[model samples]
Target: MEQVAVIGAGSWGTALAMVLANNQHNVNVWSHREDQVNEINHHHTNSKYLPDVKLPSNLVANADIQEAVENAKAILLVVPTKAIREVCRKLRPFINTNQTLIHASKGIEPETHKRISEMIEDELGEGVHDQLVVLSGPSHAEEVALKQPTTVTVSSYHLKSAEIAQDLFMNEHFRVYTNEDVVGVEIGGALKNIIALGAGISDGLGYGDNAKAALITRGLAEIARLGTQLNANPLTFAGLTGVGDLIVTCTSQHSRNWRAGNMLGRGYVLQDVLDQMGMVVEGVRTTKAAYQLSQKLNIPMPITEGLYELLFDEKDPKHVVDDLMNRGKTKELEDLSSFL
Candidate 1:
């Protein structure tokens, strides 16, 4: 069995550690919180994150970052987007070019508009870039921790690394697919959170499924628009990380982004919603990054723009909806036609 290190103990990180453990990999999870470490080691449960789940007994938690990656064959970075740089810097001294580096976290860096892979590469250098892989799709931590059937895509600049990641996580219940389009995969994965927040806001406003359906569909177009501009394969947006992820994150109760958006829609302030949720809403930060990127790149992202205004500029959720509905008209497939 391979030894794996998961460098975060949040819900997603804990869930992934369980996956590795269940696959018979010796998995060590590192968390900054000692209390969380103690809980995982002694009780085998991360109550705060996965309240109803029992983590695999083989899954171990480490408070020490160095101890966690001591001899891991692969390392999975599952921290929030904002924490990625710090985590990578902490991991730098412990990591080598030999170990495969994979990140499951989604969201672009607000300052750099960089994907998680780029941020990791920046901190860890090009040696890690060659081995870097991204795990993304519609899979949720809640469902995956319960050993539910979940399929996800792993992508990398190097095909062999992607295949290695595929072998590392593939199992009866956790199916893995490999793709070479890292750009598409990362972009699709990150941008979907923004749309999910919009979807949540739409739902929170009690606009119903009809509004959500429109937001999701149009949101994919917006995502593809920016993704293609970044040199990603357009078809990738139609796959699991694209439409599939958008649909799941936007609709599922398990999505923190959606939940946060719902609260915002229901008339709660941004900080209050975040405080109440007690989790990092990646979408809020991502919305800012995306809004900035769209402005700089001159790409049109109406829903994202609306959400950004709602989250950051304190625009009324209903007014944001009105603004979206009042946007200039264009052919539905205008964006796709260029790609075709």
Candidate 2:
């Protein structure tokens, strides 16, 4: 049994800790909130995040970040994108060269347009760990906590490191696959949240399945466009982290980004929606980053642009949809052919 440390105690982090514990790993979860740590240790519950789910009894919680990573064989960083730098800085002092560092959080860093792995590397620097791996796909934390069947991909610059992460997280209910397309995997995982918010807005605007279907399909096209510009394997968008993640995040009620978008579509103001969710809606930040990146790269991301205008420009959602529909038409296959 290997000792693992999960660096965040949010829903995703807690659920992942349960997965590690179930796999018979000695898992230590670190949370800044003392109350959350106490609740996890004494009651084996993280009610605020995973409301009805009980965490694995073997999964321990730690308030001290140093204590959590002290002897860990692997460390999984699952905090929000905004907190990644802070967490990585905190972890740098304790991280040893032997431990593998993996991150499951998704979202591009606004302004910098850096992926989670890039941000981690910037903060932790070189030679701090065996490898920097990213864990991403369609799996939801709530369902994973219930031991439902889920599959995800792990990617790293090093194939061996990806394989190592795959071995660490794979199980009967939780299957893990390894991919070497770190650029594709990270880009797909991050951009899908932008599409998901659009999906939520579509549904909230009382539009039927037709609108959402168009959003999801064209959204994939937009994602592939930006991804390829960044040198990602075009085929990766067809895989789990790309299409699979987009479908789940865009359609499911479990998605915080979608939920926040729904609130926005239902006429709630941006600040109000954020206040109500009480969680970092990664898509909100991702949309801004993606919008800026698309402009910088001269890539066309209509859906993302629309969402950016709606979220930040205070434009009406229906008007944004109208703007999207009114755009000049182009041959769909013409775009698909470029990826080939």
Best by lDDT: 2
Question: Candidates' lDDT values, in order?
Answer: 0.91, 0.92
What lDDT tens digits, residue by residue, belong to model 2 across residues 136-219?
999889999999999999999888888888888899999999888998999999999999999988888999999999999999
What are the per-residue Cα lDDT tens digits for candidate 1 across 55-87? 887799898999999999999999999999998
lDDT for model 1, please: 0.91
Report the CA-based lDDT of candidate 2 relative to the real structure: 0.92
Give TM-scores for every candidate, taking all chains together and pairing residue i with residue i: 0.98, 0.98
Backbone clashes in model 2, listed as residue pairs: none
Error of 1 at 294 (Å): 0.8
